[model samples]
Target chain A: MTSLPTHTEKKLGLAIDLDTCVGCQACVTACKGWNDQGYGAPLSDQDPYGAAPSGAFLNRVHSYEITPDQGAAVIVNFPRSCLHCEDAPCVPVCPTGASYKRVEDGIVLVNEDACIGCGLCAWACPYGAREMDGDVGVMKKCTLCVDRIYNEHLPEEDRVPACVRTCPTGARHFGDFADPDSTVSQLAKQRGGYDLMPDLGTRPTNKYLPPRRKDAPDMSAPLAPLLDIQATGFAGWLDKVLGKI
Target chain B: MHPAPSVIVFTVLSGMGFGLLAFLGAGLPAPSGWAAFFHWGLGYSLAVGGLLASTFHLGNPQRFLRAFTQWRSSWLSREAIASVACLLALAPVALSNWLGFGWPRALGLIGAVLALATIFCTAMIYAQLKTIPRWNHWTTPALFVAFAGAGGAILAGQSGAGAVMSALLLALLLAAFRIGDGAFAARAQTLGTATGLGTIGPVQGTVRVFEQPHTSPNYLMREMIYLVARKHVQKLRSVTLIGAGIAPALLLPLTPPSLLGFAVIALVHLTGAFAARWLFFAQAEHVVGLYYGQR
Candidate 1:
């Protein structure tokens, strides 16, 4: 099972927009809530109310504050998850046939029953996507909401991943990337969507929309004098009031 | 990468075991009767015991039997297969030698080749990982082979001349491994490349951790973001070089050619090998560490 298929028919993945994300972490919580009770094991936490609390979740949002010397300051909220790569490195490294890529939808999944929980797949991944569930002794990752996405009981609109549905700013999009005319594919082409660590050749299925630069007012030009030092306080106040009116 | 105790024990002990088997298979004179039994017992104890120790590292040790089935793709599985084959082939030879009638030379030759192949497979498990910049190199397996050969020569009571040659080779390989490991640069990916922010401007400009997603250490941080202090690392490197390389090279040559001398040299060399293996895991910088700004 570690030997990858020649090609999967459909590449179902997420396209995240960096420009619109607010770093609210709603998607992270939603993913935990859904996966905890659904599909596999619960996203268990140790000492939740104690001083040191840690829990395993499929998604995490990292905030980077970029203060450039000359350009405008940019704050980027990067949400990290499994890109579900076409040539997933995690799959081949697994000793047991636990880590596998789906032939149907191209969704990479871990077979908990077959896993020996060696943690080699985690070491193989360039992205910090896979987490070893200590409670159950198996690797856990983003299933792309495999349970809910295919369930007939769910509403048509609710068939998407929990993370995608929970995104407040609509930053996350889930669709079949194989379809050239699909909304996800079109958005990727239009916004110049790019892959993370393209050099590694994992060929990640998820695409990230680069943050657009905002045009700032030019500071190079000579500034107009705010107020003449020679002018009286009363005159300056009157000028400011007249300018506002 | 954390220097897990089980892995360290497995690599060092198993390396010696395979090394002894390789020398034995290469026609190191098979001792008569009880001596042959004792020799075979020692080799199996080291090799099989080390292999068993490695299972402790797995989260689900009971499910380890399934690991042998993925030999088609997984290096770990290949290592398992090679190791089992080496043991099986060597066992009959050892048994025949114990009964005072050694097996044919061809069978011993096959076992020797398999023993070396087992070590190579074990090294490949680490070397094949593109994620770790330090371990992804040809020199890693070479080091493994050299260490195993040197340890095996000493453990098997090889002739004084052979032991001296192995010690010298070990020294050269250790030096080469150190230099190569130091000189190699990580050309694959950086924080800028990982985030796709390098396309916009300099990635260095955007390298700041505003906030972490979790307050406490998560599994990723514990497993991947291990940090060994520079001072400690330097000290350990010196210890490894002296214990595994210089001391063995010098002491093995100078000491009287006796079982006790060989035993002393073996013990000293193993200490160095252990230190070296620890450094192997500790210094390896995983690409995922870049995501956490640890790079």
Candidate 2:
């Protein structure tokens, strides 16, 4: 019962544009607000009014500073959440058949009622997408707004996930990757949307478009001695490693 | 890996119990009447106590009954089934030995295999996790079976076999540590691959976390990003090598053939088993820790 579906009918997922994300955390707030009442268990905060306040959140935006050889350091806001992998490791490792991936839309979800809270699923996941709810003792993760996305009451524009809806910069996009014509799929093809930790072979549904090059150096101009910039730092080290591979 | 005391206790105690059961089932130091009662009593206490301790590792332990339903796919479920089967299969033999009924010995033999499997299942729970490269190797299961076999041999008063198993265990433990030290690095999971930023293009300096998502501890940080024992891992590794492996290997061959002698050797071995189990969890490096720029 914990085995993954042979195939999902529709790969419904998000395409997060890192180039425009400002790391305002508005989507995090929106995700928290919607998931608190919309999902299986409400997000709980321990010691919210006291020292060491912590709470469960479906979506979190992390800021990273990227520095290039010859320019200012560029800060990219990376939002971390469940990638809804096709071969989700979390599902097969579940001892109670609590963690499962949907065959219809390919969204990974935890059945709170069946969950024994053994936490093996969380350990199976390399991306740390699943979190054990301290208050409820069941695993919780990004549902991709399963309730809201299919709800008939919500208007067409409002049917998207709360994270996509509240992203002020329009950095988050929602669509089905199953259809080649879908916006998400096209974006993936055009912008090179890639998986997180491709080495693990999870085959994540959600894709992240790399931040566009910050400063464009003119290639047509003749090579000048002063302009001969040798790549250094992490990218140089990375090139050497990739060269080894 | 948080190295919760419940899980550590479960592995150490249950491992020794199952090991003893295996040896007894195989007719090592076969006994009758009062002797059988004493041996079975000790075995069951350790086995049952260790199994019960695992129940505390669960947040909703009452629902652990559901853990049995997914054995076809889950190792933890398989372990639950195996442990129960082993205990049940051995009960009749234990009673037969105690009361001189002379019931079929096949029951004990079946239980022995199951107990060995139970130990393997416990190891697979950690070994199956690819997220932790260090524990994902075959050595994990080998180490588990070794510890149980050595510890069980000591409890059964088979000093020669105990000494031999302990020496093998020592060799495996050292190899596991040596291989494990490079397992994470061999995988090359870095902040670069973690975020896919390292593959994008060259950067000015490096890809680094400018700010974390939250100020306070979250479930991911609490459960996966544990680092309390990182600094003292070298010391703890020594504790495992000396206590669980070396002491038993050297002393078992010299100890007199007596229950009291085995008890002392077993105590020394079990102490090392506890420390080794602790290091198994403490030293495991989860890939999720890369998000926080950790191992």
Candidate 3:
């Protein structure tokens, strides 16, 4: 059962814009709030207010400062979750049939009932997408908000992953990547979206838009003198009078 | 990469157990009566005990039975299935040997094959992980086989010279694996490749870790970012080579063939195996750590 399906009907995935993400962690909190309450297991905290608190959460944002040669340093906010890879290594490595990919939508999920919590899947995942819920003793990861996305109770417009719905900067976009005309696909094409560690060959469904380059400050314009010698003494009085005029 | 003690014990002990079982099942010297009992006892105990210890690593040990159900793909599942099959096949051989009767040669052959297969499955569990570049290599399996063969030869050998030769060969092979593994450079990916920023320019000059995602250590950091000091690891590596390889190779030849001598050699080898396993896990650098700049 751990063997992936030959093909999924739709490649439902996300397109994350690195250029627009401000790293506010709103998506992280929003994902926690929804998934914790909505469906399946709650993201449990061991010592919520204690000295060393650790718990399981699906979505996490990592802030990185990247310095390129011949340019100023760039701060990149990398939000990571389950990539729902075309060939997910985590799926086949599970001893139990607990970890599997949905044939319909290409969403990788863990069947908590079947999971032995051996932590092999976590090791298999290159992105470190899976985390163990120590309280319940089961592997937990982002389900692409499966519960909310499919719920009829929620308004149509709001029927998306909580992280996507709550992104203030609209950096995260969710859609079927199989459709060439899909908004996600269009964004990916326009921004030249790329995969993280493409050499690993997981063929991650999610794409990251590279950070846009900021134009270097123009140095051709006339420069101002650092110290105004004329303004220091008698010329200072004359300059002050000229400035008033 | 945390070098979980349960896993370390499982790999080392189970490897020796199965390796000895393979040798015994192949009718090595065809021991009679009490000697046969000792062989069967040591082999079964090591194999079963190692399997039991492995369950301790699982968060939900009660679900251990489910692990055997997915042998079609998962190496862990194959390991579980193969372990059971190997034990079952060897049961008859052990029983026949203990009762002073010769078992069918074909039955012993099957058990021997299964035992080796089980060890191979165990090796594949780590060998297949592309995420950990250190573990994802042919040398991982080769090292596992070498360790098992050396340990088993000491326990199962009828002659001192044979045991000495096996241990020496193990030492040589261990050195080869270590040298080869160390010499191999990581060419596939780096911090820039991990972040998809290598396309932009040189990442080292442009990037730095401004802040970690969490205020404290998280599961990913704890599990993947295990950083052992180089000096400490070098000391431990010496301990491993000396205790597991050099000591046993020397002691097995010099000491007279006695239970006490075997016990001393086994102890040293086990310590060496433990150290080697610890380094194996600790040294493995998972690609995920690149995001945190741990690698």
Candidate 4:
């Protein structure tokens, strides 16, 4: 007889490639749309169409403009979501064990029925992945589209997460990071990717590759006489307003 | 941070409970009949519920006993020890009151001091966490004490306090508000320190949101992005100053010893105190805001 899979043995997770990523937010949109209608209660909004309409989003992208002393403007687009860490801090903090990391497949999920709407998990998380579903009185976050990934009805390739599948720039990738031979692991190794805020020592599964540049730009180029003049027509006025050439 | 509703409820409920018990032990007159029973039962029940709710904040509730070991350096540990001590002190006081010992005045004093100490310890837990700038303040402990006193006084008035004690408690509530304002100033100073800038001076350079460190809101923003309108803060302060402060001060001195007056005072104070506590947590900013490039 074949042995059944145990929680400790199986590992599942995601790896993102920053090298090829063009900063598109396809993954963010896809995650929101998928998680919004999936197994858990929809992310609640205080004022959906009114002023200050803020709601819970499972995934979001942050753009950072890093200006090195002698280099061109480097815009680093960081997509933030649940890292689904092997040592997930959010799990043990939950009093009811509602927030738990699955023994099998290593997926961190929230059991809505058991959640008491306490925001402790939210406080424990350094990533801010989790949010309170105020309407249902429970915490919610990215499940990595657990239901879709394991659905037998779907095609084998389509069984992967909606975010991974929808990513236009191929920035988001899903696989077992535990297995060194997996595509994500190989990519992470090859590109020398780094985790966000590694000092926290959460050992986040998601890795980000720092933006690389080849040569420094020359800022000492001689300026045109028209450009150097402080006063002129429309172009001069625009330059004065923006404080830029 | 997302103030867990259970925790919010727990703190408020327990503050009232411990506060009421402490006040009763502080030489306040004994309440009569069902009112007195509720004063004791509700106070202890809320205290238990608050402690239980706080367990949810821990990574391992089962291993919470280990927390007591760190009392040497940890305010959380001190809070745990103090809370347990308050419970132990209350046991004898409760037993004596039941046995018709005329409300064991000495034990009452002990329980009251312990209860206030627990509240102070609870505030210190947050104040000690250097990461959360909003919590790390001398005012936090004072605020917790005030809330406890206010909540307790309100409950006492409802449970039948004579005009003198009511007036005295009311005065304490006003003193708490003044202390809270001082705490707010401290919080603002600490926030400025966290940003690596001194004081609330105007920005010297053209500040622009060029790029953020992350694409999405991280833990810092989620916990500390507690934005309330300036106008609303002003309005709430005014209401608290009057309802929780001035009204209690004026009415307690004039009102006759009646349950109706007490109930009105209790309800008004409870609402005002809760608002004050909420604002206390919300208005305070953290040092982590510096990472987001916000001053």
Quick one: best lDDT, which candidate?
A: 2
Question: Model 3, residue B131: displacement in angstroms?
Answer: 1.0
- On residues B1-295, what C-alpha lDDT tens digit does candidate 3 reach at each position? 8888999999999998988888888887467788888888998999999999999988898998999889999999999999999999988888898896676877888988998898899999998998887788777777787677777767776446435545664665466446535532544576666887756522334455688787877788888788856447777787788877778777777778787777778888888888888888888778888878785
Give the per-residue lDDT of model 3 (tens digit) for A184-207. 999999888888777788999998
DockQ values, each candidate: 0.60, 0.48, 0.63, 0.06
Interface RMSD of candidate number 2: 1.7
Ranking by DockQ: 3, 1, 2, 4
Runs of candidate 2 with Cα error greater than 4 angstroms are A216-245, B201-205
Q: lDDT per prediction?
A: 0.84, 0.89, 0.84, 0.63
lDDT order of candidates, best first?
A: 2, 1, 3, 4
Would you list the clashing residue pairs of candidate 4? A7-A103, A7-A104, A61-B215, A62-B214, A62-B215, B1-B223, B22-B112, B25-B108
Can you tell me which runs of candidate 1 are displaced by over 4 Å? A221-245, B159-185, B201-205
Would you give me the overall lDDT of model 4? 0.63
Give the per-residue lDDT of model 4 (tens digit) for B96-140: 554555654777788889999988877765655443445555656
**Steric clash pairs (candidate 3):** A65-B207, A65-B208, A66-B206, A66-B207, A67-B205, A67-B206, A67-B207, A68-B206, A231-A236
lDDT of 4 by residue, A174-225 (tens): 8887788988788778766556444444567766544445454455764655
Candidate 2 chain B: worst-modelled 10 consecutive residues by lDDT = B197-206
Native contact share for candidate 2: 0.77
Which candidate leads in DockQ? 3
For each candidate in turn, the TM-score is: 0.93, 0.93, 0.93, 0.60
- State the lDDT of candidate 2 residue by residue for A163-206, as single tens digits: 99989999999999999999999998888898999889899999
